[model samples]
Target: MTLTSKQRAHLRGLSHSLKPTAHVGKDGVTPAVVRSLLETFQQHELVKVRVLENAPDSAKSLAHEIAEKLAGAHVVQTMGRNVTLYRPDPEEPTIALPR
Candidate 1:
């Protein structure tokens, strides 16, 4: 699913106060990291991921990698060391995107 501009903005706004749930360390995007992302998606639907200073790649690359690994997740925003992703949970979606 694709996020419209308004929806992206909405998600971005929501991310402001959210703490990073997953951190990409020097190991980069490992299977363990992806697994954590999956759990984050399952629980939070929308989550913030942080790329540490020692991470192997850029935040954008890590965001895309996370999105690609997950089924419905997409990168909504990225700023400096942080990136936000959204993947609506069919069971219980807490976020309401702008149409």
Candidate 2:
């Protein structure tokens, strides 16, 4: 599902305190990384994923790729070397974005 700009901004703010739950490393968005992301999403509806500098793809590309793979919305917020992503959980949702 696509999130409106307002919803995205709200989610961004909510994810501010959350550290990266999973990191995409040199291997980029590998199956393991995707699996981890999925698991993280299941636990926390909104999560921040860190894209390591060593990753082969840019933060934008990686974020888009992950979003597509998981069929979830993607929010890219960057601070220096880290890129944060927010994707809603399909199963048990712990956080609900503002409507």
Clash count list over all predictions: 0, 0
lDDT per residue, candidate 1, 13-67, as tens digits? 9889999999999999999999988876777888999999999889998889889
lDDT of 2: 0.75
lDDT of 1 at 98: 74
Q: Any runs in candidate 2 off by more than 4 Å, and if so which?
A: 76-80
What is the C-alpha lDDT profile of model 2 across 11-97, one tens digit per residue? Answer: 778767888778888988899988887877766777677888798988777877887788665755666546666665557565666
Each model's TM-score? 0.94, 0.82
- Candidate 2 residue-wise lDDT at 76: 50
Clashing pairs in 2: none
lDDT of 1 at 25: 97
lDDT of 1: 0.89
